[model samples]
Target: MLMTSEWAIILDEVDELSNMILSSEQAHSLRHAYTAVYKDEELAVEIAAFQRMKDHYEDVQRFGKYHPDYHTIMKKIREQKRALDLNERVAALKIAENDYQDLLDEVSLLIGRSVSDAVKVPVSNPFFASSGSCGTGCGTGGGCSCSS
Candidate 1:
């Protein structure tokens, strides 16, 4: 039976540990994506090892039920889960930001290509003749021809 203060401390530590794991996982995934882009097998292996450590931490929490500090540990585990949930929300936001940045890049490329294509085409002004007179009569020097 753990004292209330001791249990509180344990729970706090568990929450902190959980936050650490979640933050590490998020960083790992981001780095993994970046490394995969560069085809870095060594970094991939390192990331896998980190993932295994995270799994081991989860296993420790699961088997904590058999320990004398079961209640305290379980409470801590629940707090950890809450911390993980918050981490996931943050990771999602980062992913969304990346996606938005990619979209902007694509749109910028498309606009550049479109503008280039447009520049390649010949533009015609229907109101201007080869003699540089306006077709609209006002500037044609025809004295605004009208029958009314």
Candidate 2:
């Protein structure tokens, strides 16, 4: 069984590994590269159009059920959503985020498993015998059950 001090050593190692430069750099680079690839002209235009349609839909809804522009605004909103969906950059960004998330999740699970496995019941006192009291009186010369 691992003692408390042994468990502490495992936890300390996990913390050190989490803080290492390589892991930090990989996470940072994955995020930065993903964002850099997403900052494109067409994707921005689609995003803006989607936002505009969303706002227009909201404004039209205020005019009640018979508002003349309600159906047209709703249709435009759906089309804008589709446009955004069709953009390849959006898909790439999602993939990148998912990949990074998977890596992070794996690391977290490993740490949790290791820490759980390291825990143990406290050790019995070194000086005390399991059967009864401590010291030379335990099992010598009629002091206890043992035959000398």
| Candidate 2 C-alpha lDDT tens digits along 1-148 | 7579889998898678777634665577666756765577666776777888888888888995688988888888888887766766676666666666555544544454466633221212322222232323334574554323
- Top candidate on TM-score is 2
Give each model's clash number. 0, 0
Q: In model 1, which runs have C-alpha deviations exceeding 4 angstroms? A: 1-38, 64-148
lDDT of every model, 2 decimals: 0.48, 0.61
Put down candidate 1 lDDT per residue, 6-73, tens digits, no spaces: 89997897688556544654555666655443365554454455456556556666776675666764
Best by lDDT: 2
How does residue 94 of candidate 2 score in lDDT?
Answer: 62
Off by over 4 Å in 2: 1-29, 36-38, 52-70, 117-148
What TM-score goes with each of the models?
Answer: 0.23, 0.46
lDDT of 2: 0.61
